[model samples]
Target: MRRGMRPLLALAVTLGASTVAHAHSVHAGLSADGRLVVSAAPAAGLTRFDPHARSPPHRLPSAGGTESTVSVLIDHAAMESGLAPSLLRAVVQQESAFNPAAVSRAGAAGLMQLMPGTARRFGVHDRFDPAQNLRGGAAYLAWLLRHFNHDTDLALAAYNAGEGSVHRHGNQIPPFAETQAYVRSVRRYEAQWIRKLRAE
Candidate 1:
């Protein structure tokens, strides 16, 4: 498939109404605070990765400056990583809103809000560099997808809350408010991007 069409194709595969419904049913029930209600506290010994919990969430930036350039980079990374461009866009939006200079309070940086360890693990030398950051983030997401057997919700949960947190919670989304909201927001953005791509 053409690079441009990959998002559309993934839309068909990943963005069905059933996905959202099932996610709500399986990963999170309807909590008044939108937190994941669990029968027990999350297991111990997992390093919780919740950057957004420390940093105030950023609104999507107005499109200008690096916007077009970031789109190109996202497409290139998506192509090389075999990830959906819509999903990449959604992650970038949720992470840094396309700001390559963005850094979270917890020390995550760049468009993907990669931590120092994650950047190094993904061979991302310059996390402030848009291309490298997107590449690293996409590669990590792809690996998470495989690690979680292509379960998008689990992969997304791992993205926000760490793989160990998911495993600690018995291969489920960790019972964290921020992580649950992060997964929900990213999925919402992915769906919006898919709809826009289909319209275009």
Candidate 2:
């Protein structure tokens, strides 16, 4: 584990996947019902094809309050990786707003916007798989947080602009506007989720 090491490359992959749910038009959640449910981005989240392998039931976590079928999966993934569920939710919000089928213009895929190389490094063969995507993203985030001494800001900055940029700027958040905004946005989401958890 390289602490505070600069990341020169985006965790990227070149494989093409469905930008939105394309297998079938239904809620492909972690349930035995096999009912496809899109929470926020319906058109962008619903699947046209059936995603087999029923998702694990939504288990309520200690902090995130009552979890939805969709949310429970993310919360569990974060918790399994020794992370705060709220923080990971914030990242998912920023990355793809929990859209497992999302694909960024930069080729970042799945819910976490994982780049091709990064996806492979994280063992995410199917970026569109929500479970796999969330697991991989949480793993990467945990690694980054450790590398940055638990400095959420620095870790997020590195996550957005690559750790290399942080190192180049003397182990601080880079000056890139996109990276700066991204860090701020993620933190804001983090705070929001934290508050939500407390209220719950």
Candidate 3:
């Protein structure tokens, strides 16, 4: 078996046993196995796999403990877009830890940790601008969702590593420990979000 198949196989094996719960008021459901399983409700929006799953879920520190400008920006954007404040918070936290002024060794910057080229493409003049940075990051995520056909895991893997890396590996999660862990972390959070949505 190819090494890339390991994670998928593992996921399949674990799918039937996992259970998630969360506290929130939303309309959605998650399967016992952890795949995004939604109930038949009109209010529940579309659910599908994304092809260009590239970004990973960022882990942020707790609020009121060590707040940062990037965290505030992400929270504001999530609120404005109605895309789950916690999800955005988690993404940014994992990406840059709410560092509005963070610059990755690879040149990713700002709250969402936008790459220099990505920032320019998104028309963001200043990655430090909280609003602009969040908007660009969110926009990039939306693009990735479309690219990956809504497969959250794939999209996240691509985000952490790069779309090229995912493609080079035959559309599988790349062989990077950080990227792999990032996907799992985001999926766990997403599961929680879905659970909360369903409980409501």
- All candidates' TM-scores? 0.69, 0.70, 0.58
Could you give the candidate ranking by lDDT, starting with the highest?
1, 2, 3
Q: Write the per-residue lDDT of candidate 2 for residues 85-170, one digit (tens) a residue.
A: 88898888888655455666677876678888888998988876767888898899898999999998998998888888899999
Candidate lDDT (C-alpha), each = 0.70, 0.64, 0.57
Alpha-carbon runs more than 4 Å astray in model 1: 1-66
Each prediction's number of clashing residue pairs: 0, 25, 26
Instruction: Kindly provide the TM-score of model 2 when superposed on the true structure, using C-alpha atoms.
Output: 0.70
Which order, best to worst by TM-score?
Answer: 2, 1, 3
Report the alpha-carbon TM-score of model 1 versus the true structure: 0.69
The global Cα lDDT (0 to 1) of model 1 is: 0.70
Per-residue lDDT tens digits of candidate 3, residues 84-153? 6656666776776654545666767766788888888877876655568888887777667668887767
lDDT of 2: 0.64
Top candidate when judged by lDDT against the true structure: 1
Q: After superposition, how far is residue 39 of candidate 2 from its true place, in Å?
A: 18
